[model samples]
Target chain A: MKVKLAKNYGFCFGVRRAIKLAESKPNGITLGPLIHNAKEIERLKENFNVVVNENIQEIPKDSEVIIRTHGIPKQDLELLKQKTKNITDATCPFVTKPQEICEKMSAEGYQIIIFGDEKHPEVKGVMSYCKNTPLVIEDLMALKNSKIQEKVALISQTTKNIESFLQIVDFLVRNCAECRVFNTICNATFDNQESARNLAKEVDIMIIVGGKNSSNTKQLYNISKEYCKDCYLIEDYLELRKSWFDGKKLCGVSAGASTPNWIIDKVVQDIEKL
Target chain B: MKVKLAKNYGFCFGVRRAIKLAESKPNGITLGPLIHNAKEIERLKENFNVVVNENIQEIPKDSEVIIRTHGIPKQDLELLKQKTKNITDATCPFVTKPQEICEKMSAEGYQIIIFGDEKHPEVKGVMSYCKNTPLVIEDLMALKNSKIQEKVALISQTTKNIESFLQIVDFLVRNCAECRVFNTICNATFDNQESARNLAKEVDIMIIVGGKNSSNTKQLYNISKEYCKDCYLIEDYLELRKSWFDGKKLCGVSAGASTPNWIIDKVVQDIEKL
Candidate 1:
């Protein structure tokens, strides 16, 4: 059986920059674990003395604080900067756009309606950018709690489903007299989804490659599962259970952004052996 | 021609909440336009006194501050609260999930990765929730900038395409050693998209009902367009030109969440007339 791997899959620019930054300096402390994969963290730990800083205050004074690719909150960044002059900011440019939008919408006095997962770190960071106590809701009833008005500024978390974002936007537009929406979902994000959808259509057994803790990876698993019943998630060659691919002839491989090219190669090689 | 409407069509809960809040009392002040719809905003102006407060300092103290279904950044909200005590929040619950994720990630020392349009209000709100500087990416570059090992969290701005969100997630898991993620897309959102996809398959002409400024409506238009070339977006009966009836037999109508029932009814009537 041949293994087909997605060409555009793996760690993105921001993630690369972050990893390079971590590897650039032998001495650095990560706020927590960097990325979602366990194997990668172990590798990084061997090269650099990376420690998870749970308490901001507990961080060594003037320690080289490298903001992860996902980025720390604005306040945290400010605090890091204040504490240490040496701060490496690896925040993605796309992420910064949401901050600017919140500042603009909140300043305009529009009821800031953010459509996103309330528990995700990215959502939390975007929330800090607001100028007012922006009301947030996931469903219809919760949306009702927000004061209805002619002016509502709508936005989505960068990773939100575009279709879902539109539904939320539609809801706000229908109920509110005036709704201003900015399509904040990343362009690459959308393309990745489109590609996955297209790929899923052609595959019999889909294998999503990513860390279990990775949000995007989990979403990939879920999406592939919807189309391909044999879809399953595994981190690397080690996790590839031979049992799942009993007599599987065709397997489509797709990896999360954080995934390294080396790992993708390894997975393909392992699948070929199977 | 006979017209059939979608079961889950029309103004969603968030839109209704925002509109109701705007039109509510004898005294009301919106931070900006209630929604993006021009007609609806015009209607709101007729019924209520809508005001835009762009300059944070310009807001009068003790004013009744109303939050739109589109959320604001956390910092802006704090600044607004500092100026006024009374706030009417009208936001959807699904939208708030990203905020929670940001907060949790920040507290736990994970970097926050947001997937959505960075410029959108929803993304902004999620950033604020983190109270930290987050890396917001709309594309695969986000994976490069995500958390490493022990500290990365991923989330989507609600209203995002589930397919898109999953691709980004998949990237994270494959590369990142340790990451946490949440599939925050609302249930109603998926249902709407699925319905549209299904309808597009069986209809000769599909009519999308909602405001031009509505994102979900546009998405619906895009979906229908993919399957049927004759998909039309109508804010109300006014936009439904007679050309739409060129040789259509069965027409499918789907409204956005923010579209009022009246608007859908008017469109339905117009289709019937056609």
Candidate 2:
């Protein structure tokens, strides 16, 4: 099977910036995984002595702590400020924009409507910025069931689908008296998804290379599955199966924003060997 | 042929309020046609001596002026205030909401986007409220071509199709950093259009009753034509034709927000006679 890479893939601006920031500060403790990719996290641990510590209470006082790209909650960040003097924030600017918008709009008395997964850390962080309680909805059903105020401010997760975000906007504008929407979806995510979708249409079998827990990677996988039924999502070359590529004439590869270039190259090399 | 009336049609809240206000103040000169329906305007003039004056400069000093339902330009209103103390604002609260939103949002440094015909009086009125130059787009192509700012405030004409308005909102949300959308489309307009759409599907022939210049009536006619090809837009019973009822098993009747019930009833009665 001949392998082709998606036009746009691998480390996005935010992930690349976060990695560089984390690499510069050796012996730093990240509040959470620096990025979603486990292999990259492991590499950081070995090469730069950067370790992931999920619990804020576990970190030693005055230790160098790097905030995750997803960012910590407002209260949690304040708590960390009190705990540590040496801190480096790695929160992506795309994520930070929503946080600021939520805070400002909420302060202005506009009810905030966050269109994202409630359990996602990024969403939790954005939610904390709202002075008033925000209605966090994952789907149209959740939005429909919730009671919305006349004046509303809508924000989306950076990795969410643009089509889904528009649907929420449409519903809110139709129902609410006033709706303020912040297009917080990262441009890199849109490019990756578009590339994956275009490549998936022409390929017989598709390989989505990224961390299993990565939101953008999962979205790519879901989008690719719509066009090509024979699709697989794997983290690294070791996870690739020869049986899956046996009869495939062409294979397409795509990676999430968090995915590193080296891992994608390795995956492609292994696929070629098959 | 069976003639059926749409569930919701004619004399929207704003029109009803304006008519009552105009009738109460007999011999009052309306700054412009109080409503879009010419027949209703004529009825007001004959019954209550409410005359329509298109030019603001022509009004005599200190004359009683009733503002049109569509509202007038900010400068025009200001000029009227300076000229006379006997000004009655008949501008619908729905229309007034967008004006206030545009003014407030513009004063706060957000670029305003008015989604309607540039030549429309309501749109002109809304545009005047913007402190900065507002982009008035009637279609998606215009919106795409325009150079938008980072922050935008969108308001639609009261009588525009909700679907078209939603499309503009969707595009603005995707492109702009911060988009404030005020759903200024009147509830009566929505109900009338929806009713017309529903009735159009079940009828062989659709009769849209309102003035030729009425925006909402044109929208109803356009929507009805999509489902029922045999659709006609007429001002009064005199405009109805017997040939239109030929071989039609079911006839649907709908009217614009500005259309009075009496006009709609006359059209339905004429259709029954045919």
Candidate 3:
């Protein structure tokens, strides 16, 4: 089987920036996994001596702590401020934009509507900034059913699709008397998904490598699966099945933002041997 | 045939207020017809000696000018200010609310979407307040097709139906990221339409009495027609067809904001004879 790599794959700008920040603070403890990918986090822990801990209170006082790319909720950030004097903020600026926007709009008496997965850490971080309970909608149908106020402001998580975001914007403009919309879908997620979709169209089987918990990786897999029927999401070469490559004429490879290049190369070399 | 009059009909609050204001300055020249109904305008001209002039330039300098219920464009209002020192602002406060809202929202960099007839005087007046060109959408389809902005504000002509207005509001809230809406549908129009709709449901035939040019009157006729198929819109008893009452068990009579109570009574009495 012939294998083709997606044009834009592997670590995105924000992810690279975050990993670099974590590497610089060699002895630091990240508030969460430095990134979503377990393999990448393990490498950081082993090579840079960086520890991963979810709870702020568990970390020793005055020790260096790094905020992850997904960002932390306001309460957690406040706790971190009090607990740690040596702080390394690696929160993606793209994620920071929506958080700031939600805070400003909610203060101005606008009912906030968020178009993002509610359970996602990035979405949770952004939602904490709003003064009132925001109507968190993951799909167009939920947005259609949401109760409206006289004034509303809408924003989205960094990893959401642009088309769905614009669709929600269009619906709100036609329904609300006055609306404010911000297109906060980060460029890296958009490009990666687009590249994966494009590659999937020409391949008989598609392989998307990333952590199962990574939002952008799951999105890439979902997008690729739409164009290619035989699509698989695996974290490393160990999970890859030889049966997937059987009788497949062409295969496409793509990786999520948190996926390290070394893991992708190993997966590619193993697929070539099959 | 049995004739039943709508409980709430004829001479709406805004129209009554405007007429009362015109009556106080009996000798002044109204910028336009003080109200939509021609018969009422003629009565005001003949009895109160108030003349109706469409052109601001035609009126003599320093002459008393009534602004009328529908209000005037901003430029005309400016002209009136310069040309005449004695100006009576008879513009309905309900109509004025939308105008002020459009101006304020447009100033705050919001695209204004008005749910109203584009050619309507009230809509025109509201549009004049906006610095940028406002999107005047009359129906749900037109509103759905309108291009959206990051921020949007919606207002309505005072005579628009509350149902359609709310539907538009719901659609906008679902689509726009941020939206601001003001239900500027005047109370008089809402009550009149509701009364007409209620009366039409009980009657076999309906008579809507008002000038053809009156927006609220047309709305009442449309609303009554939906519930009663044999609905007829007439200015007076002269236009009421006797054939409409043929084999009809009951007849309903309703009037618009500009329709005089005397006209409604005459139409009711004429229908009773039929």
DockQ of each: 0.03, 0.93, 0.17
lDDT of 2: 0.91
The iRMS of the candidates, in order, is: 14.1, 0.6, 7.0
lDDT of each: 0.71, 0.91, 0.87
The total of clashing pairs for model 3 equals 29
lDDT by residue (A230-249, candidate 1, tens digit) is 88788888878888888877
Over 4 Å off in model 1, which ranges? A137-149, B1-274
TM-scores for the candidates: 0.51, 0.98, 0.68
Report the C-alpha displacement of residue A61, candidate 3, in angstroms.
Answer: 4.7
Q: Which digits, one per residue and each the tens of the lDDT, describe model 1 over residues B1-274?
A: 7987776766666777788777774365666555656667667667676665556677889887777676787777898899888887766667776787789778887777787777777777788888567878777775566554434666777666666666665565444433455656655666677788888888899999887866667777887799988888877788778877887899998977777777778778878987
Question: Who is ahead in DockQ, 1 or 2?
Answer: 2
TM-score of chain A of each: 0.89, 0.98, 0.97
Model 3: which docking level applies? incorrect
Segments in model 3 whose C-alpha atoms lie over 4 Å from true places: A1-52, A61-71, A82-98, A109-274, B3-8, B140-147, B166-177, B194-202
* Better model by TM-score: candidate 1 vs candidate 2: 2
* Residue pairs with backbone atoms closer than 3 Å in model 2 (clashes): none
